[model samples]
Target: EMVMPGDNITMEVELIAPIAMEQGLRFAIREGGRTVGAGVVASIIA
Candidate 1:
């Protein structure tokens, strides 16, 4: 559950909103209104 810098891994995430889930989709992980990390959708599970 902990990711270090420059580590590439795939994790299954649950979203609370109906947002677009597709490959190449960019996203950011925020904490305290600041971006902690960022990632892109590589593949969809369903």
Candidate 2:
């Protein structure tokens, strides 16, 4: 999905596959083809 500055963003994910105890999931927020923010999903429920 493409996003512009000052835009609001929302996301929801449903995990159907098993994730390992030590596994890491990464997410990146980008604008103008450049990354503005990045983080990892430390944990998820449901």
Candidate 3:
């Protein structure tokens, strides 16, 4: 995928994991075979 310097980008995600109270789940986003963004899900309950 080719993205311009000022292009607008949107992404969707689906997380399916066994999360406990206050548990942190780590995630990362890759672009051009490299990690560009990363974050942690502080708490998620289902």
Best by TM-score: 1
Clash numbers, per candidate: 0, 0, 0
lDDT: worst 10-residue window of model 3: 14-23
Model 2 lDDT, residue 46, Cα: 51
Candidate 3 per-residue lDDT over residues 1-46, each given as its tens digit: 7665556555445546653434466676688999876656655544
Judged by lDDT against the true structure, how good is candidate 2?
Answer: 0.64
Q: Supply candidate 1's per-residue lDDT for 1.
A: 79
Mark the regions of model 3 whose C-alpha exceeds 4 Å error after superposition: 1-23, 43-46
The model with the greater lDDT, 1 or 3, is: 1
Candidate 2 lDDT tens digits, 8-45? 65555564687553326677757899999665666565
TM per candidate comes to 0.77, 0.38, 0.39
Candidate rank order under lDDT: 1, 2, 3
Q: Where is model 1 more than 4 Å wrong at Cα?
A: none
- Pairs in clash, predicted candidate 3: none
Candidate 3 CA-lDDT value? 0.59
| Residue 26, model 1: Cα distance from true site in angstroms | 1.2
Model 2 residue 46 distance off true place after TM-score fit, in angstroms? 2.5
